[model samples]
Target: MTEHAATGPVTRSMAVPLGAFAAGAVVAVLLGVFGRVHDPTLSGTTDLGFRTVIEMKVVVSTVIGVLVVLQLVGGLWLYGVLGRRVPSWLGTAHRISGAVALLLTVFVGYSCLWALGLEVGTLHNGEKVPVRAVVHGVLGCAVFGAVVVKLVAVRSRRAPGWFLPVAGGMLFTLLMVVVLTSAAWYVATDGWPSRAGY
Candidate 1:
């Protein structure tokens, strides 16, 4: 038997990915913990010269969600896991899409935290808050953690081959949750800033 055949399945150390995941989770928790809830009226007025922050978030988040879907497709193509031949430029495209997704996510996340803070109940209108809002808030924090773990797994030589795909999937799922709960809900409920609940 060859030397390769003699050894069992290889396994890489998980320290780097684990540590990175922990760090990311901590950062996310800190933001939620320390975030100060403010009046939506004051925060809602923050605009990018032409549009309010809420409008910008809705548009940006929708674009990011689309890009994330592309990232999934590109990743699968690059790995040849979907039965498609790996294009020469697929890896580059995957990387680019992932970077753009990350950047957009970061922007939206910052805007959400800064403008809305970590909120759950419907204190503004006395309406019962939907479970989707609470889940979205929780998953928003998880998105940051997932992103950090994915970044570390992608960069670490000691990370196992399966680590990257799993991390990427987790990140994608979290983003979808955030997008669906916030942007999709906003679109379905209210088109723009006609009221103060989104």
Candidate 2:
């Protein structure tokens, strides 16, 4: 009975986000596999340049980009000021939400590395170079570390109060910094000024 009670809420809380994420994963896999079989490499550069590739990159990037922004910003606010005072359910939700965000953060980092050659030693000369890859990489690492720290805090209930909150703030700052830098890099390299060959 006690075991059932404990497991029940955990399952309930995780259901919605886990379900949506799973469905999205299935769709992405289907598209990637089916789309690649016919096209092999999808779109690449042309004399007209990489309009399709760039647009596809931006659409997915922008969606996950906004989500990362929201999680970092909102997570910080929740953990820093209100964490001490919030009811237990809210705190549990905060941790659950953060776990999901960390998963997204890792996925985005790896996807960018594959899709845009953002990882070190991955870029071919002609690929679009993200000016902020190093910064984003560092933040991605930090996000991973913070997730560990958060988990430790949850497990060790006597963990220092400051550990979790500081981690939250760090995540918030790192994400925003990466997003702004990436945006700047995109504009600088791909904007009309460069496109016009000026």
Candidate 3:
């Protein structure tokens, strides 16, 4: 009689997650360190007014946040995590959404890092910085890092079956954190573009 062999060691299964986590952490640390060293003034100028660019970023981020949600839903559907049969076309939709999301993220990240640097708070002659701003910057870096991890997990042939789902979840959560701290905060404080006080 023939017997079936079990899967390999638990450590082998964990390799992808551990590697992705390490890579993401490295990316976050690098971005934070870069922001600390770089001067905001040295950033590239946009043809649009400063406030206009900021407002544009907010809009883009909101749209990206929506896309992230859709991506998450698509992922869930594809994995049968919702206990529903995934349509064949759903895979294509998910890929398209993921591509668009990544593109949007790249644009926003460039604009943020180039135009604003890591703006924690306004430094007075003697005053305490706002904790929110600091948290926002940290989360922004983490968003990028999570994206990197997701991309790596998706493309890696050796990655475990669970890697993509976990990476996608992390990416979605980080994106939401970034949106809440930056775009949502902006909308709350400034309202929409036309009515924004700048």
lDDT of each: 0.78, 0.49, 0.80
TM-score of each predicted structure versus truth: 0.81, 0.47, 0.82
Candidate 2 at residue 144, lDDT? Answer: 46
Q: Write the per-residue lDDT of candidate 3 for residues 1-198, one digit (tens) a residue.
A: 323236443343567778888988999989887876777653464524445677878888888999999998898888788898889899999999889988988888877777667766565365655787788788888888898899888877677887888888888988888888778999899886542454
Model 2: per-residue lDDT, tens digit, 1-198?
A: 797696664322333333433443454444334322333333333222334444433433455456666555455556564355545565566556556666655555444433443243334575753546655654544544444544544454344455445545555666556655554456566652222232
Q: Candidate 1: deviation at residue 43, Å? A: 6.1
RMSD of each: 5.2, 10.4, 4.5
Report the lDDT tens digits of candidate 1 across residue range 163-187.
8888888898999989998888888
* Superposed model 3: Cα runs more than 4 Å off: 1-13, 42-51, 121-127, 195-198
lDDT for predicted candidate 1 compared with the true structure: 0.78
Error of 3 at 33 (Å): 1.1
Return the lDDT, model 2, position 49: 37
Q: Show the colliding residue pairs in model 2.
A: none
In model 3, the worst 10-residue window by lDDT is: 1-10
